[model samples]
Target: MASGVDLVIFGATGDLSRRKILPSLGALVARERTKLRVIGAGRSHDTTDQFRELVKEASGNPALAATAEWVTLDYADPASFAPINALITGTAVVIFYLATPPETFSPILVAIANSAMVTKGDPSRRVVLEKPLGYDRKSAKELNAQLATAFDESQVYRIDHYLAKDTVQNVLAFRFSNSLFEPVWNRNLVETIQITVAEEEGIRQRAGYYDQTGAVRDIFQNHVLQLLALVTMEPPTTFDPDYVRRAKRAALRAMSPLDVTSAVRGQYEGYLDEPGVSLESRRETYAAARVSIENWRWDGVPIFVRTGKALRRRATEVVIKLRDAPLDR
Candidate 1:
C-alpha cells in the first residue's frame, strides 16, 4: 500500500463501473482530490486506449475522459494484477473495486492474494465486494469464511449501495444521536417497517442472468435485508467496529428463518413469452415476503420486502411506519 491511495476498478468497462463509478470518481478528481489514482481493469479485450475512450464517453465528461487510465487486466490472472500493484506503490491505499458477478469473486480474491496485491503487512490495503454475496444463507457463510482466510474482517468492506443513501444514514443518526427518537425506536414505539424496491421494466436483455437469480437472490437477500437491519438494529454501545457489527449481526440472526409460506414468488407470463426468454425457466420475476424478528425490540413487527422485473414504475425507497404518534386531542 502506498501513502496516499489508488482505486483499481476490476470491471471498469462494465455497466456499473462506467455509469456510476467513473462519473463519481471524476467528480472527486475534478474537485482536486486526485490523490486517488484509478486503474480500470476488466475482461474486455480492449487495449488501454480503447478502454480509456470507453470510460470517457460513458462518463460523459470530457475532462474526466482525458485523465482516465485504462488497463487490460483479467481478474483471474495473477500476472495481470501486477500492474495495478505497480501503479500505487509506496504506502498508498489500495482499494480493489470488484464490479463483477458474485461467481467471479473467489477466483479474483485468490489471484489478488497470490499477486502481492493484498499486502499482509500493510494496514491500508482494502478490497470492496459488491452484493449478491451468495445465492442463499449457506453460500453466504461459505463466501464469508473464504474471505476471512485472507483478509481480516476489518479489511473487507461489503458494499451494499442502498446503505449509502442519505435517508438510511439519517436513520442511524436520528435514532442514536437524539433522545427524542431512541425511547420510541423499538417494537413498542414502532409499528412495522416496509422496504420496497420496485421496478417496472421486465427482464429484457437480463433474461439469461435474471433467470438464475430471481428477485430473492437479486435484491432481497442483500439489499432489502441490509435496509431491514439498519432500520431495526439496536444502537451500538459505541461507534467501534465490533460493537456496530455485533448489533447488526444480532438483528439478522433475530429474523425468523424464512419459510416458503411466508413469502410469495411470481413470474410474469408475457416476460417469458418475450422474444428471447425461454418458456421453461424457473426464475421468479417478482417476490414479496413478510418477515418477523424474534427480538424484544421488534418481536411482533413484520418487515416486508418485494421486488420484481418487467412491469410498473421504477422507484426505490423505504417506508417506516412509526407507532408513537401524538393524539389529536
Candidate 2:
C-alpha cells in the first residue's frame, strides 16, 4: 500500500479475471484513475513480462497491463503467500478480491489471516468475495464465521456484479427519491414482483463447477435474492451505507420461509451431455421460487424469483405487477 490503495485480484488466471475484472480495470485505467495500484496473483509461473502480455491479450489494452505487477504461487501451499506479503508495502489500504471459487475462499482467507495482510481489526485491509457465498444458511454461516476470523464485517464486501447494473443500482433512487411511489409501494397496489435472470449460453466449459452449483446455488442464492431484497427493503432512515444495509437486513429477515411445494428445479434438455457432466446428474440449470415477505408493507405480495441457463433470453430483469382496480371487472 502507498498513498492510494492496492487492489489484489486472486485467481488472476481464471475466467473471471480474463473476462470481467481485467477488462473492467483496463477501462478504468483508460479513464481518470491514477493513484490506485493493481496486482494480479495466481498460480501462473509466467514471468512478469509474460503475465503482462497475457493481461494485454485478454484485455486488449497494453497500458493497463503495463501498470500491473504479477505474483505467482501454488494456491495449495499457504507458505507461498510470502511474495504477496512482500508486495504489501506502505500504509495505504490493501483490498483482496477473492476472484476464485467458493471452495478456495476458506483456504485463501486462512492463508491471508496467517499472513500480515490482515491484522486485528485492520480497516486498511478489506476482502471482496464474489457471488455464490454459500449453498445454504448453514454453509453460509460457516463461511461467515471463517471470514470473521480475518476481518470485520465492514472489511468484507460480498459482491454480486448484477447488483451493480445501472438499472438495479437505481432501485433506491427510483423508489425513495420519488414521493409518489413510496406511498403506493405496498401489497395493496402491487400484485407480484417477478425477478428473472436468464442465461442463453449452456454450460460451455463450466460443467464441473455448474453441476455442483446449479441455478439455485449459483444465481438464486446471491443475485436473485439481492434483487428481491432491493424490491422488498423498507425505506432507510437515510441513504447512507449503514442505514441502507440495516434496512436490507431487516427486509431479508422478514422474507417468507421456503416451501418445497412452491419450489421448482429443472435441467436443460442437453445438460446431461455437457462435457465433464455425469449422466446421472440431477443438477438443475433452472430454479424458481415464490417468496412472500411477511412485513407491514408487503404482507400479501408474492415475490417470484427465477433463474435459468440455456434458456430463451440472456437477460436479468425485475418486473413488478400492479393490482387491478376494483372496477376493472
Candidate 3:
C-alpha cells in the first residue's frame, strides 16, 4: 500500500469538520491503518499546533493530531492557496474535500484550478464536494461545467454522506437479495412510501448557510431524493457503480415534478431568534412533499418525503406501507 495520502479540508474549522469529518478520520486511521496527512484549511488564524489540538479534541486520536497541519485559505484570494500547494508533493495522491457552503464552491474551484494541486485527468488527485451542489438545476449544470474545467469527471466526487449509512446501503441488498420482498416491491402490493428525516437540533452555527439553503435545498434535494431513488430504482445489471448510478438516474427521471399543491413548508417557532439569521427570514425549517413516479413499477403509488429540524425527536426512517391482502369470497 502507498505509505501516505494528503487530505486537505477547506472548511476545517466549521461544525461539520468538528462533528463529523474529524471524528470519522480518527476511526479511519485506527481501522484501516492508512497514513493520512490531514491539512486543515480555513480563514481562521489558528496555528499548526492549535489546529492539531483541535483535531485531537474532535477526532479523539493523538496520532491524527501528530501528523496534522494547518493553512490559511481565503476563497476570495487565489494567492492564499499557495501554502496548500507547497505542502503537497507533485506525485502525492491528494484529496481536496470542500466542506464549505455551496456558494463558495465556484471561487474555491477556480483557486484549485489555478493551483498546482490538481492536474486534469490525473487519477492521483481527487476533489470531494458536498451537496447541495447548486441552488437549482441551471446553477447545478453551471457548477458541473466549472468542475469539468478543472478536473475530470472521474476525479470529481459529488458526495452525500448519508448514503454511507448501513441502513441506507442495506436498502439495496434487502431489496435485491430477498425473494420475499422483491416480488411485492411494486405498486400492486404497496400502498405508500414515506421517508422522514427529522432532527431535534436547531441551526446552531449553521444559521448563515441554513437560512439561505432552507430545508428543501439542505436535505430534500439531495439526501431525501437519493433515498427515494434507491427505493424505487430498478435492479441494475451489475453491482458496478456506473450501473447503479444509471439506474438511480432513471428512477429520478421517472419521478413526476413535485406539485406545489402537494407540498407544505414551515419555519420552527424559535428559528427567527437564531444568531446570523435574518430577522425577516421566511425560510422553512420543515418541508414535505408528495411525489409520484410514472414508471410502471411505481405508477399510482404516493411517495411522501418530509424533513425538519427542531422537531419532537430525531429520526431518519423510510416506511413502506403495503396494500391489504385480497379477500376470498
Please name the candidate that would achieve the greatest TM-score relative to the true structure: 3
Best by lDDT: 3
Candidate with better lDDT, 2 vs 3: 3
Over 1-329, each residue of candidate 2 has an lDDT whose tens digit, in order, gives 45676788998877788888888877776686645566888876868787788789887678767767788876778898988888877848888998987878878888888877787578889999998887777888999999988788889898888876898889889898999888889988998989999999998878757888888888887788778888889988998878988998999999878999999999999999999999999999999988889999999888888899999889888888888888984
lDDT of 1 by residue, 31-93 (tens): 875665567877777776787687677666556566456667766677877776677667457
Per-candidate Cα lDDT values, in order, are: 0.76, 0.84, 0.92
Candidate 1's TM-score: 0.83
Compose the digit string of candidate 3's lDDT tens values, residues 187-236: 99999999999999999989979999999999998899999999999999
Against the true structure, candidate 2 reaches a TM-score of 0.90
lDDT-sorted candidate list, best first? 3, 2, 1
Candidate 3 ranges beyond 4 A from true positions? 1-3, 326-329
Overlapping backbone residue pairs in candidate 3 total 0
**In model 1, where is the ten-residue run with the lowest total lDDT?**
59-68
**Error of model 1, residue 315, in angstroms:** 3.2
